[model samples]
Target: MIDGERDLIREMARLTHSPLGHAELVYPWGQGVLSGVSGPRKWQREVLEAIGEHLTGSATRHRPCRIARASGHGIGKSALIAMVVKWALDTCVDTRIILTANTESQLLTKTGPEIAKWANLSITSDWFTATATALSSTRKGHERSWRADLVTWSTSNTEAFAGLHNMGKRIVLVFDEASGINAKVWEVALGALTDADTEIIFLAFGNPTQSTGTFRGLFGKQRDLWNTAQIDSRTVEGTNKAYLGELVATYGLDSDLVRVRVLGQFPSASSMQFIERAVVSAARTREPAPALGTDPVIFGVDCARFGDDHSTLAIRCGRDARSRPWKRWHHMDSMTLAGDIAVEAGRWKPDAIFVDAGNIGAAVIDRLRQLLPDILVSEVWFGSTRVREANWNAGGSGGTRIRVANKRAEMWTNMRHWLESGCIPDHQGLEDDLTGPEYGFDAEQAVMLEKKDHMKARGLASPDDGDALACTFAEPVQPRAVPGWLDPERYGRQRGGSEEGGLYRDLGNG
Candidate 1:
């Protein structure tokens, strides 16, 4: 190598011990002024220190260096991430780096360009060639081994993250806008950390836009597993003070948006989450209390039409609801599911059975009618108009008036009300499904439940259990009374002074 190449390699080796060394060498930071751009913010220096410790000073070998940062707008998170990427490439030989963002547009438009801009200004700029998806080392000996690739990940295609093993070499993985990346991608990325001796660094930087998932968990359940940081824009120098003031004025300092954008805090509730976990937990713990003066025995069915999704059956008797687990049958015929429902309805003798008739549900309804001639079966199409007369008033002079965008929305709203006032069997799947979808208001200002497609895109499984429970609200039904001839006391005696046992038997314990 020539004298210049030799000097470059020497400096790179010296900077390997500290990210601060690499940053000082590349940027012209003299006195208090930063040349070319504004000086590095305090938060940026802190991030560099954390990365430096993980890369070189970490005492343990078993745990890889994991840094998760949640920051507000204009905190220069992207610029800091770019600096780390360049530092890793220059300091570590034979290194492999992968950069990703929440979406392809974000990766291409924002993250990719920011990295390229910084790479152009670095002292060793001539050593690499920047492309749209990759930055390749142009040096004679390290052309192939030293490079960083930008890979956009998605739920449908995860192959980009597979087979990322670089034992005995440095590996840097950076996730920008990390909150929007699905949990599945995070799981896939874990496979890359298998190399025991690899100098590995995992950096996740994003705004606290999502309250649930891997990014949020870093500050919660997985706090001990990561070196976490929260950077508020207002605390940092060079941020737009006017913009921050306007936001605080419009949405209050304590609002969710302000908490996320200014205070660098996760919202108390997820932006789109419809139901709260605390409410669900309370419902599960409370004792069963059926509604007075009403039988209120209702059955709800959500049919499965495609791929791994389950056909679920939920039964509610007054305020007490049976725990109905979702059942999946691969390529099962419609008539078979109908037969199963018919048997359940016959035993429970529900006041009403509401079946979601959007897809293959019509066939199930037909077969159900044939099997139980006296059954009160209703075909409920979710896309149909929401029946306004079915609105339920929980209590008080002005109850939580439920008005939804469509039938599906109305049913879900009713299900939420049920969870608040009634009792449900303790089940994890049911809880997850119940709290899955987020809600919004349509043009008409009615509550609109998010589409299933959106939920699937976010790596959430089909909420069949929740949907089945919601179907029970398709229409209101008065409880069927016992025959006038049968004495109330005698009927109670036959059922052991309570009808709960018979109710359980009617719904089938399973």
Candidate 2:
């Protein structure tokens, strides 16, 4: 390493000497190591200066200010912040660095341990001891005060935010991993920034998740608030893939925790409850084999009515190694008891009938069991009771007698895989459900949820056909044999009525 690189590492080492407080920060890095010069690089130096500049410039009244940064992952952002915190603590007297994250556990698991480790290794002074200053609230249900005692580590909350009220005096409130902060939390932090001399350094880092929310709101003019560096997975300059392999050996790659903790990127949640998208898309591509009834069939049922949501039936005739949903028949209906299912069940004559034992479904299920008594009946359940319910209370479930539906979320995931992979022949199923503003991935919980509590509130109560179609992906399937005496022709589209009746053609008589 060059003299400058060595000097930079020495500087980083020296930050451990800083005085600990409520608003001071100490983060010093060896330019070569921190920024990637020969032994490291200049990027670190530039980033540090940029931060210094932003702080000075934003301090309009020399008032402590706020800085927000939204950047992608893996550019050594966390290391940089630690170094800065170290620097601030070493130089400023009683400097308080109020560090906060989405939760105290996250701050502990993600930031605290690492900072403590670094200090342990670098500090020559006998000053730092780590313990929780805040963990529980008072018996009266007020904010906890444990943080009031600890100098180096403290619980972070709106109350701890009193640190931000020191005006004219220099203070720094650092928000670690700001992506998880919601609007409510944002306001709490805002309220605490009552100090003019308090430097508001909002350092946030996260990967892309949605087009809306906090990170999206900070995209353009405010990006400079953060250095917003993104380090891609190519070889970092000084090493080849194998050399990089050596580094990986020192770090735990198997720990998905490391990805977010060390680099600030959201890791894959590892979902396994549903069929993957490739399976759904592949199933869509499959043509009904003439051999299905002879072999056995797996059915997909979607029982949404046509007015607002669709009713769909997806019939798959095989298992995973060769599973395929050969057909998806969907439509919207103004009337609930349209007799379409009894007619189709007759034609499809599935090895089993997989129906959503949900809203308006009991009548349909009863109708099918009455007509196709010889065929096995399986009522598949999906969604909440507020939205729909399968009356499993009617009987118990055992091997294939009938099965409760798997989580609708798992089913939706499987469906997403199909749509994005381009393997599915028709995206119509996903299209109808997600195309509307009603669907959105929740920002806080990191899952999809209804955007509006009362969708279609202004209008008449309408069934969601998209839900019906989606249910097909998650619906329980089974195979059933046709009655020994039944004919495929007899299953023609007709609600059970006199064969030569007073039926309307639109009701399926035509």
Candidate 3:
């Protein structure tokens, strides 16, 4: 690399390490003085130089440039974006740069004033109309307001950026704190890039999140079009020792932010999860061939009827020096009720099979029994028993741990534990179902609003999926489940008949 290129990278890293000022912003093309571009702090300087480098780069002269920055909170994100806007307006005439955030109030309240504070219009006017909020330039008719040539909104809302005409001019569309926007809004914001004559420069900044969908994919894709950088919390450790202390102290040494923004990595996404997503995600890779007797030797059966439910069977080895615990699942809701699950279950010769005794489980269980009576197919039935579930108080300040009674609560909990640990180590179907964020523990509690609903409810939404998954891996607790008002044999017959259980049995419906 040339010394100039090396200097730019060094200066960029240096600026990133400390504060920035307008005067400190030196372009290789020409270093000139600007109005209020000087930032008085470390992060400020970093941001200014970053924006300056782009403003002066070839990307600005013709093609658009995209920069994705993942920054820590209070890292002067809003301040830098404003200065970047000023740098753009002064150098690039008729530049229609847009400033956007998660909200509009932020635009007017935060980004707007930052520009107004630094934008020093040429005082060509020899006289000023004090009564009217207008200043006449000495060059007369050349009077310009001390205002920003920028627009901002709280949302990556499409409408806010709509009606934009690039007109062969480069467009600087800045998406600040993009993680706050929804998927649809993000799509709309990105669509603004497709304008003709508009060399769409997509600039986005946000804290890292593992669950971020498309942004993650773009940055992850092996390409040269995008430049990405991460400003970690540790960058401010020496300066903001207090905040750093609290983070390290309050969150312990294993801080999520350390793994996230500091490392420029996506942290584990799931809540209530025992193991990390990174560990689970890595397990998806193909491992080398296992020595003899290393491949899986057991299958788990968590079966369900067709239509509106999931019928899953997972296989795990007794010992896996050769393979990771893998799970495979099939959604019965996507199909119809049939004896196909039973046939498939018999072929595996699993060490043990756990089946839930609700609805079609009984018939499937019975059929599997008919096929391989000797195979240890453990039948899990439910009775009203106490189960542990976390209950939160009204204020949302904190929560309480308590036990509530539920039919298959224990089974669900254990299944989650096993899946989380990658112990169900062979079936991809179970792995996928368990990995999905949609399972809920249906305890027999009749208290407050549902606590463990889906993400909205802070609970998994695919409990049915979890059911098929857990049942496939569950160790049976009860001999049988017999809801009141039904004969044992009749109950089994009725459950076997319907995909969704019988009219008489009011088991865990959801």
Candidate 4:
């Protein structure tokens, strides 16, 4: 190595012994390029102090040190993360660092770019090369050993986190926007903390948007293990006080929205409302899918055995889904309900029908088969083992696979994804039912939906409409051509010798 680079490394070693030393040496304060730049805030300094102390004391210990921060908007969480990353890279040689966020866009647009910008401004910028997903030492022997990786967490490829092992060296794991991260990712990440005689630092930072998750557990069940801090923007220096006051006034101090966006507080209770009201409302008012008539129409049926529950049928044409107006049946015999379903199937000629096969649903299915044997109907059991086969990608030639806890969880997650992107009609019953069920995890940390009894205890009716809609995601179905009534121009212009003409002729004969 060159004399200047060696001297720089020696200087960094001395400076990293304390957080303030590292900050003072690396930051370009009152100098060329970035003149008059200030260091971390008081709260951020506290976090750095804890990290420095932990590294000094745990030079020989096996246990990992964890620091997690929950903060409101614009408190500079990303900046603090950038500082810690530079400190680790400059101070320690052959350190392995993994940085991940909830999504790829967040990492690409914000977290990863900020780190690169700060790293470029450092005195030892020549020592490392910054790429899109990683930063690595450019020196000969140290090229592979010293690097920091940036990634977005996904259910697949979690094994990328399992390969990090730096014995007797430093290991740093940073998670940004951690609230939405799955529990499985957190579980697998624990394996990376097992190297003995290594300095380990795990930092998780995000807004407290989710009330239940590993992030929330940092302030709840797992509080004893983490050195945690909550930073409200209003209290921090240089924050917009007027905007904060307006937010508090607009949302009120007690609203969940205010607590998350202003106060840096976890929601007061578990999120009983699975889908947000605003998101649902916006989707309800959005335009219907253009392919509504040109794609397959699938039917989702939820059967009711007793009580005040209603057996309902939900129809989804491509991304456009709505429950039939007269699909709800109360205290109807299985034969009668099956006959009604057969009539609808004959009239609509849906591509595929998914029926809940739990409890009395099997009897209803048996009755339906006796009435219409040729109808394409599939039985779904919510509590059965999830159907985890490869799904055919219509756009591509291969099949893609996904993992889920069970049928119910898989369908609900699918429904949630659809709600975020697709349109739903404005129906009062559908809105209430969609927002009712809360999510929880099972003992093995698998995703689980709240039971009907749980919803009833919370004074919400059984989510029959929601359940019927969720059933459409049970398994992949074959797509068919458009029906005549839904294809307005084709039926209106071509009046003779086509499928549209045949449909009208049959209706007139009937």
Top TM-score prediction, candidate number: 1
lDDT of 1 at 227: 90
Segments in model 4 whose C-alpha atoms lie over 4 Å from true places: 1-3, 31-36, 58-61, 269-510
Taking all chains together, the TM-score of candidate 1 against the true structure is 0.72
Q: Candidate 3, residues 106-184: lDDT per residue as tens digits?
A: 5566655554443432121122221111122223443443222334442333575665546665466776665544444
List model 4 lDDT by residue over 240-267, tens digit each. Answer: 8899899999989998877887888877
lDDT of 3: 0.47
Candidate ranking under lDDT, highest first, comes to 1, 4, 3, 2
lDDT tens readout by residue for model 1, 246-319:
99999998898998998888876686788776677687788877454336578888988778687888888777
**Ranking of all predicted structures according to TM-score, beginning with the best and ending with the worst:** 1, 4, 3, 2
TM-score of each: 0.72, 0.39, 0.53, 0.56
What 10-residue stretch in candidate 2 is worst by lDDT? 18-27
lDDT of 2 at 209: 34
In model 2, which runs have C-alpha deviations exceeding 4 angstroms? 1-43, 58-78, 101-110, 113-158, 177-187, 206-227, 233-510
Clashes within 3 Å, all models in order:
1, 52, 44, 1
Position 387, candidate 1: lDDT: 42
Tell me how far candidate 1 lies from the true structure as C-alpha RMSD in angstroms: 7.0
lDDT by residue (tens digit), candidate 2, 133-251: 32222224323321112222222434645444544443555666555555445555566556555544445544433222344345533555434554333323332445445444666
Of 2 and 4, the candidate ranking higher by lDDT = 4
